[model samples]
Target: MTAISRTGAGRRGVATLICGALAAGGLAAAGAAALAPGAAYASSHREAPLISGTPQYDNTDVYAFVSPDKPDSTTIIANWIPFEEPAGGPNFFQFAEDAQYDLHIDNNGDAKDDLIFRYTFNTHTKNKKTFLYNTGVVESLDDPDLNITQTYDLELIKLKNKRVEHETKLADDVPVAPSNVGKASMPYYSKLRDQAIYKLPNDAKTFAGQADDPFFLDLRVFDLLYGGDLSEVGNDTLKGYNVNSIALQVPTDLIAESKHQPIVGIWSTTQRRNAQGYYEQVSRLGNPLVNEVVNPIKDKDKFNASEPKDDAQFLKNVTNPELPKLIEAIYKIKAPAEPRNDLVDVFLKGVKGLNQPPYVTPSEELRLNTSIKPSMHPKRLGVLDGDNAGFPNGRRLTDDVIDASLQVVEGELVGSKNDLGDAVDKNDKSFEKYFPYVALPTEGSRGKTAKSSADTKSALGDGLTGATSENTPLIAASAGAGAAGILLIGGGLMWWRRMRRNY
Candidate 1:
C-alpha cells in the first residue's frame, strides 16, 4: 500500500496489561493465541483467512543481507502487494494508519530479533472541497496542472530491549515530510519516490515507496491453475506488475559483530498500536504481501483484516494450517502426515519458488553461511546452485529460483539430476543503480489502447524466443499443438479442486 493512504489514524495505545506481561516475559504477545495441536500446515504467503482480504497488511516477502555494494553495511528489502497495477488509481492502495511497519534484525540468532527498526506513516488528503474527477487540472485548480497536491509524514524508531545497542548513530529519529507530487509530476513518480530516501549513519540510506514490482511469477496462470504445478505456465506472465517496497542500506559493522560472519534475519511488520494511546493500524506488511496467487477464501476482505504486528500469530497459524488438513481430507491424500510439520519448515526456512512433493512440510529457515564471502560478481546461482545468496540468506530479484528449487526438491543437491527443463527469468529486466531501484513502464504507456492484449502476447512470444529459445520450453513449446491442451487440463483440474475446498 502507498504511504499516502494511511492519513489521520491515531497512534497506538499501550498494550493491555496481559500483552505487557507477555512482552516482559520474553514471549511474543501475538503468539499467545494457540493453534490446534495436530493440523496440516502451509506457507504464510496466502495462509491466513483474515489477511487474504487486506492485501496491504499482508506480509509478502522479506529480505536481509550485508550489502555487496557496501561491504560495511546490511541492506533490508521488504515488498508488499504483489502484481500491483501501475494505474490502480481512482482508489489506489495505502498502508493502514493503525499499523506499525517494522524491520526486524536478528543480530544474535536463536530465531529472535535483536534490533528492530519501526516505522509509521501519517497521511493527509487535501483539496477535499474540489468536485472535479481530475482535481489537479487547470480547470479544477484555476491554475496550471499543479494545484492538486497530497502530502504525508514518516517516523522511524530503533529499539534494543534484550539485544546490543550501538553507541553512535547516523540518521536522526524524526518524522519527515514527503512532497505531494500531483499529475504534473506523475511521470516522475519514480524520481519522487527516490527523493523520499532517509540517509543513515555511516553512509546508510533508507526509502519506502510504490514501484514496479521486481518479482516475476505467473500469478494469474497459477491462480487459474489453482495449486497445480506452476512449471508449465512459464515466467514471462509475471512481467510488468507493480508493488510497494521498503529498502534500507546500513553499514556492515552495525549489522554484523566482526564482519567475519554476520548473520541476520530480516522481516517486516506493521502495528496498529503504539506505546502511547496512538493507534495507527497497518493494512500491509512485507514485500509482495498477497498478490502472487489466488486465495480461495474471501481474499480481499481477509487481507484488510491483517497487520504485521500479528506476525507471531501468523507463524503460529502456518505452523498448524487447518486448511491443508481439510484439503487432505477432501482429497483423501492419506489424511496427510501427522502434525503437519511440513508447513513449519517452509515458513521458517524453505527456499522460495522451490516446492517439491508435499509442498507444506516445515524445514529450517534459510541459512546463509556468511563465512563464504560472496564474489564481487557471483554467478547468479540459486539455492540449489551451491551458492548461498538465494533463499535462506536473502532473496534477490534475479535469482533463477524456480530452477534452483525444482532441482533441490528433485534431490539434485544430493547428487541426483532431474531436469524440469528451463524457463525464462522474468525479473531479469535491469534494475536501477540506486535507491528505489524498480522501474516500471508508465501507466499511459501501458493503457489498453496503448498496448492491447494481443500486442502484449505477441511481444512476449517474440521476446521469449530469439536466441534463447533452446533454453526455455515455453518458447520451444509455443507452437506445439497438444501442449496448450495438456496445460489446460492440468490447470483446470487443479483449479477445480482448489475451488472446491473450504478454508
Candidate 2:
C-alpha cells in the first residue's frame, strides 16, 4: 500500500466556491462538487485497521466527475488492489468471488445511498495442468487459448430509507479484462482493454479491469516529516504501481433523481460473506485519507464500520488534526488553528454555494454536481486554479489532489497565500478522454524498473516501475494507517514518465 503524506501547496489558492447552474430553482444541469480530504498521492490504500487484512476487498481510491467527452454522462471510477507488482506471479491479482464491490450514490445529503451499483466476480481456469495466466492469448477477450478467465455480474439497486426497494441486474455477463502479461502473449493490450467496455440498456457504460494507478504522490513524507530536504520530497512513490479499477458512466438524471436536490453524495465500499452466510462490511471510503491520516489506532475500524450519517462523532479530529501539528513540530511551519470551521465547510458540509446540500450533517463523502460543464483545459489545482471541473468539486484523474489538500492543511484557506508541492505532477500514463478514462495498467511482466510495451521511458531512462523488484518486501499494514505511524509507499526515489493529461 502507498502511504499518504502532506501535499505541497501550489502557485494558486483554492477557495470554497460552489458554482452550479440550477434550472427552474430545481436540480438542473449545472457544475457542482463536494470536498474530500486529500492525502499524499497514495489516496486511500488499505487504510482501515480491520480491512487492511483483506487486500482483495480493500479499496484504494474513488473518483467521480462529469465526463469531459460525454458531458451528459457522469463518470465514476473506483480502484482496488493497490501496490500490485507487475510480475507478481502465475496467479496475479483477481477480484475475490465472494467479495461484493459497490459504488453508492446519495443524491440528497442525507448521508444515505439512494442508488447502489453492486458487482461480484468468478474466476475459471481452462487448464489446471500448467500454472499460467494465459496459455496463448493470441486473440480477443474470448480467445480459446485464453486458459484463465474471470467474469462478473452487475446489479443496480434502489434503496428507500436504506431498505432495498428495487434491484436490477445488468443484461450482459461482464468479462473481466485479463492482466497485462506481456507483448508476447497479450500483444495488443489496448484493444483487449477496450473490449471490456460494456454498454447497458439505459445507455450507461461500465468497465471492470486493471488500469494504471491514476494516483501520483511523493512518498518522501516519511523523511520529510523528520525535516528532510524539500527537493528530495519531489520523488513520487506511487509511480508505475498498478491497481484494479471499476468505472461507470451513467446519465445525470439517474444520479440526481430528486428534482428538489441536485447535489448528490458519493462513496464506495467492499463487503464479504462470513461463514454464517451474512455479508460483513469490511472497508469503506468517501472523503480520501480520513481513516488513514485522522482517526486514532483504536478508532480506525470503528470509523470504517460507521456510516456518513454518524460522521458528526469524528468532527473533533478533523477540527484539530494531528498531521499539521506534526508538520509544524518537525518543519516549523505554522498550520491552521483548531475548531477548523474552514475544513468543516470545505470537506464535511460542502461549500455553501458550491457543493454542500441545503440541509446536511457534516459527513466525509466526495460531493459532485451533475450539472457542471466540463473544462477544456482542466487544471491540476482544481477549484483553486478556478477550474471548477476538478477535485474538491468532483475528482478527475488529472486533479492534483495532494497539492490542493496540502494547501488547505497548512492554513492556505480563501484569501490566504501559499506554495507547497511534492513536484511529481501527473499520472504515470496518459488518461483517456472517453468512458473508462483511467489509462492502461503497467504490464505485470515487467521487472522492477524494467520497461514493457505499455511503459514509456522517462528522461532518466527509468520507466515508472515502482517497487516491483523481487527484493522489495510486503509492507506491514500498521505502517500504513491511523495513529500507527505514517505508512511506507513504494521503494526508491521514483522517476515519472512526463505525459500530457489534457484529453
Q: Best-fitting candidate, measured by TM-score?
A: 2
lDDT (10s digit) by residue, model 2, range 1-503:
01112233435242211100000010100000122322111145766667778788888888899888888888899999888877776888899989899999988787778999999899988766556676554357897556677888999999988999989988446888878876666778888888999989778999998888888765545443524344344455778888889999988888986646767888898888999998887777765555666666776777666677666666565566666666555455665666666666777667666777877756778888777688998888777666766777768899877666665655557434555545556887799878898888888664333243223222212112232432223222322353333222221112122223332
TM-score of each: 0.58, 0.80
Poorly placed runs, candidate 2 (over 4 Å): 1-42, 223-227, 258-260, 446-503
Candidate 1 segments exceeding 4 Å error: 1-47, 131-185, 220-232, 235-237, 273-374, 414-416, 421-424, 440-503
TM-score between model 1 and native: 0.58
Q: How many residue pairs clash in model 1? A: 65
Model 1 error, position 82 (Å): 3.4
Error of 2 at 319 (Å): 1.4
354 in model 1: Cα distance from truth in Å? 20
